[model samples]
Each structure stands twice: as structure tokens, then as C-alpha cells.
Target: MVETTSHTATVRLPGSKSVTARALFLAALADGTSRLITPLEAADTVAFADGLSTLGFPVDRGGDVWSITGNPTGPPAETAVVWCHDSGTAARFLPALVSLGAGDFVIDASEQMRARPMGPLLRALGSLGVRVHAANGDRIPLRIDADGVEGGVVQVDAGASSQYLSALCLMAPGTRNGLTIEVLDEVSVPYVELTLAMMREFGVTATRQGSRITIGPGTYQARDYVIEPDASTASYFFAAAAVTGNTVTVLGLGRNSRQGDLRFATEVLSAMGCEVTVDDDRTTVTGPTHLRSPGEVVMRDISDTMMTLAAIAPYADGPVRITDVGNCRIKESDRIDAMASALDACGITVHTGADWLEITPGRPHSALVQTRADHRIAMSMSVLGIRTAGIRFDDADCVGKTFPGFHQELAGLQEAWQRG
Candidate 1:
């Protein structure tokens, strides 16, 4: 970490990856043709769209507005192999989707994503009468023998990932008798809420009572949908503002947005002494004279931003402890360890627990940060480069998983900050 400096810049981000993925899933399951305006064109989304196309769902990824012809009866292909690549969303959500069709589907992921857990979703599908087999056991490179799904009571453990539950919810409306999800344990409940909200937007009703959610048998009616800007991706820019004592305004993401990651601005950044203004259509963050520690912040619901918080924590006045995010251990990388290691390489004092990490204030010297091929790691670590001149990354291009232009955007902000 380096001494804070003042700067100001405004950034326009891509569409929400969460929303784009869910919209593609919902639209493909709709009753008619659907139009998605300004959807994210990234590696993860492209993998998702390709997965859908492989499963026999038609997707036209030509321009700003991509179109998908809905297939309420599930994928038309009787046999398909989906190459999920490194996209966890594609890996988790696609299985439940293919189960709605009468076919044999093989879901294969990249080495990184295959290491993440998938047993919960598979077990829930099995309970719902879909025959599933994981070659690696609980991980992907699994096979789904689909004859169609029957909607009844299903129990799912979403503690490891909320995508498992969201996957089920997205596919519930197409089940034969509707679906009732009994979430045994869950993390990132807000993401599940986003999934539900999108489902309702597509003309389906899903109700949640306590830990149980029920979706009745219905067909999604296609309509033109506008995707919200990605809040998770915006976090790096907001962290830039906080770290450098600058003002960074992100256009199109507001307090009213359904993305749970937006709370990073309202909750985490605000707690860390940043002046946060969340309007209906935009969010702005201005850093303090110097950063202050918010102490312990439980980031289970917004765990995706945990890396952002950790990267900037060493700049604060005191130690910052982020807890309740054990799920961080299983993201695109073992984020808790990865962030701890990167901070250590920066010569910062850090400690770790099973699920938490604490960063003690120190001057983070420039170091060669190992990105582990995780996009968040690369982007979060890049924020340090704003102050630490010699900071570098081994695989910065991993940000292409979401924002391919991250390096350029941060460079622009750094230039503006320097000129001032």
C-alpha cells in the first residue's frame, strides 16, 4: 500500500454477468422468442451461450441485442457435450437445464472449474428423478441421463454455492409438477433472490418462505429484457476510489439494482469510511482522507467482493477482518489463500483462518502477483498497482473471463490520478 492521493473518474461497465447468464437460461426456457439488449459479451457468457446452443437451444450472438428462441420443453438434443470451460455458472446451471430434456448430456469444465464442488446440485437432481454421475465424484465432467424432470419436494445444500439452488430455481418452472426447494443450508442468498426476481420478470411466480422456495409449473413468456450492469465487476473501480482517496462513479448500477454485490458500496465501502452515494441509476464512492478499518465484515452474501476488500485492506489505518466467507475458498480459485499469498508477496502482514483472513496495515511493496488464472485475483491485485509502482501480474489477461478491458480502464484512471 502507498500513501493515498485524490483523483476522480467515471466508468461505464458491461452488463451484469449474473443477469446475462440467468437471462439466457430463462429466455431459452421461455414460450416464445426473447430479446436480450446489451448483454455481456465475455468468455463466461459466451461459454454459456455456446452450452445452450450445444444443447439444441438456438442463440444468435450477433450484436448488442442477442436473441434466443425459447424451448419450454427443454433442450431438443438427445445427446450433447457441453464444454463449460472455466465458467462456474455454465457448469452449475447447465446441468439442471439439460435435465429438463429427454437426453444424455455430458457437462465438462476446465481444470479450474472442475475442481469446484457440484455434488449438491447433482444430488438434488437425482432426488428429483434425474440420473446423474460425476466421474470425479461431486465435481463436474459429469453425465446427466435426462428423461425429463418431475417437480416435487427437493432438498439442496447450497452452502458451498448458491448457484446450485439458483440452477434448480431456474429450471423449476419447466418441471412436470412444479418444484419446491428446501434449502438445507445456503450462502449468498441474495444471488438466489436475483435469480428469483429474473424468473418473475419472465412471467413465472416463485415464492420464498423462510428457507423453502416453491415454483409452480409454468412456461416462461419471452419478452425484451434489459440486463443491469455488473455490480461485482464494478467493485474493482470502487475499490480504486477508496484506495487512492478518489471519487469514482459507475454508471447504471444503483441502490435499486437487484445485484447483491452492490451492497459492497452501501455496506462494506461505507463501513470503511468512504463517502458512498447510491442513487437510483448510479453509485459513487469518494475515499476518505485516509482509509479506516471497518473491523470484521461478514461477506458471505457478497463474497465475490471479498478479494477487492482484502486487496485494499492493508491500506487501512488498522487491521481488517473479513469473515463468514468460507465459500471464498472454493471460487474460481481458493481466493482466501490466493489473496493472502498475494498480499504476503507485497510484503504486507496477513493472517488466515479456515474461512477468514486479517490484513494488518503495512506498506505493500510492489511484487509479482500470481493471479492463479482467476479474474478477480488479477483485477483486485491490479488496484494495488495504482500506488505501488512495481506491482505486476503473471496472468493479468485472466480478466478476460469478465472484463477484458480492465487493464486499460485502470490505466486510464491511473493516468487521470497522476495528472491531477
Candidate 2:
């Protein structure tokens, strides 16, 4: 394990993983060929792109960009076994997409992915006239017998996963019946907006009358799309600024980034006593003399930053309360529990509830953090270890899920800081 050192640095992050993955999926379903510039090449995005190819989408990657010639109507074949690996997006989003083809398809994933929940999305698919075969009650390693979607009204409990709503919306335009999606509870409103924004980019419009959305019969137009730098990944570096009392600038994510996770800086960082600056193509965070507690924050939209704030909690002057992030439980791991447990293992005072966590300011000791193969856990914990000591983890490579070469970038940042 390498000790992290933070100094004033400009960190150029990879493209937004969420946008890249969403674009890849949309590109594969577009009317013509679409090109993606500076797309993220991480494990999850690769899994998404590869999964699309496996399902007969034929993604072409070359030179400075990648292109996909899509079948706007849907996948060309009827029967396919989609290999989702451990990508939650692919595992959840692909089934609805495959429903567009009138065939029997099996959706399977890696061991870890299989452990994640899929029941809600499965039930939502079932309501859309897709025949599902999940012996274990609509989980992964499931099969679908779909004769195309007869979309009408689908009720989704977005509390578990917003991808359920996004998947249905993306496939809605191609469905003969279109779709009227009603959200019982939405975990992340921004994620759904990102989906809607991309759908518009593809020349389709989804009308949302409050909690219900109507989408249909519109064709997806193929166009060149550029992905933004990851706001989630930028959260850690922004935390580095707050913790190390240095300036950290994340390049490429601007003031108007659609990635809702960017609010980590605007909300969490500023509330934590850091000065944040947003420009046209970059955001910079400058640390205060000492970090302060944000008091209480409900991360319904930017819950991915909970770990980042958790990392900074121990240094704050008061307890930090994070609520309304219960949806994080069904992510790569139960992030709330993972974070609480890791903080406990690190000798920090952590109070965990069903959906809320209160972390008290205290000095943390050397601890072996168990990451549970969660990328956010590893990266967020690493941010905490920047100025602290003996923060070790065996599964640091888990960051490859979203930010491949993450440690390399950390090392480079530290090296440059040291040289300065």
C-alpha cells in the first residue's frame, strides 16, 4: 500500500462512466451509426459495450473515438445469452433492452453481480409483457421470453434502482405500445433526468407529468455525442482538497454538468468549509484551514458521495449526518454498511441506521479496510488515507469498475506534489 500525499494539482479525470455507459446503450439502439468521443474505458463501461456486442450490436472502436451502427428497432436476433459480468447497469438495463427483440434471452452476470438485487427490475419487465424465468424470484441468472414489448403502464419502485425506469424508457420508443412509466419512489431524480436528456439527444422525447412519464413511437436519431468527465470520480479528488488544505482542480466537468454527482462539490464540499469554483470546463476546490462538519445532509441524489464525506468526517469538528441514501444499499455493495463498518474498523466513531449514518469527528488509526469489492468504497477510503496512515485494502483494484488506473493517478498526483 502506498501512502497518499496531496498538493495543489489539476487532475484530469476520465470521461463520465454513467454517461458513457448510457450513451453506449443508446448508440447501439440508434437509427444509424453514432460516434462517442472520449468515452470512459473502465471495466463497467467496457462490460456494457462488450455486452452490447455480445447481444449482436457490433460496436466499432478505433482511433480517437468509438462508433456503433445500431438497429433502431432493437437487437437483430431473438435469442441471446447476455453476459453482464459484474456491471449492475448492464445487468439491469440490458434485459429491458433485450425485451425489444421477440426472442428468448438469458441475462447472467458474475458471482458478485448475481448477489445484487434484480427482482424489482424483473417485475417491471414482466409487467411490460416480457416473460421472465428467475427461479429465485426475479434475480440475476434470469431468463426472458419476450415477443417484443407491449408497453402501456409500468409501475416501478425506483427506490431500489433507477435503472429500472431508465431501461424501460430507453426501450419505450421502440415498443409498439410505447410506455407510460409511473414512479412509486425515485431514489435519484438526477439519474432519470440524465436518461431523459440522453433520450432527447437521440431524437426522442419523454414527457413527464409529475411522477408519470410517457414515451413512445419516436425514433432515436444517431449523432456524435461527447461524454463528460466523471463527477463521481472527481468527488475523491475534491475531498483531497478539503482534507489536505490544498487546491484540487478537476478538469472537464463544468458548471453545468448533467452528472448529478457533481453536487458533491457544490453541496458537500462547500458545506464542509471548502471553497469551490465552477468554470466552463473545470471545477476547483480549495480547502479551508480546517474542515468543518456539514451538519446534516440528505444525499438522495448524490448518495455516491457519501463515502467521500465519510472519509472527511473524521477530520471535521463535529458529527456529520447523512440521510435518505438508503438506495445505496443495493449498489455494488451495501455502501452504508460497508462505509460504516470500514470506519469502525478504522477506529472512527460511526453510527449506522437503516438509511442514515452519523460519523463523529475523531482521529482514525491504521486499519485494513474491507472494500467488499465496491469501487466507491476503495476510492473513498483512499481519499481518507491521503493524509492519514496505514489505511490498507486488499481489493484496491475494485476501482477499475469505474476508474481504471485510479491508484496510478493517485500516485502521479502524490509524486508531482512531492516534487513541488
Clashes of each: 1, 0
Q: What's the lDDT for candidate 1?
A: 0.92
lDDT of each residue in 130-206, candidate 2, tens digit only: 88888578678988887777779889888877888888888898888789988898877898899998999889878
Q: Tens digit of lDDT per residue, candidate 1, span 1-420? A: 345666778888999999999999999999988999999999999999999999888899978999999899999899999999999999999999999999888999899988888889989999998999997778889888898887899999999999999999999999999999999999998999999999999999999999999999999999999887899999999999998888988999997899999989889999988999999899999988788899999999999999999999988989999999999899898999999999999999889999999999888888999999999999998887776779898997999999888899888876776776
Return the TM-score for each candidate structure. 0.98, 0.96
Best by lDDT: 1
The regions of model 1 sitting more than 4 angstroms off are 1-5, 418-420
Candidate 2: misplaced stretches above 4 Å? Answer: 1-7
RMSD of each: 1.2, 2.4
* TM-score of candidate 1 relative to the true fold: 0.98
Best candidate (score: TM-score): 1
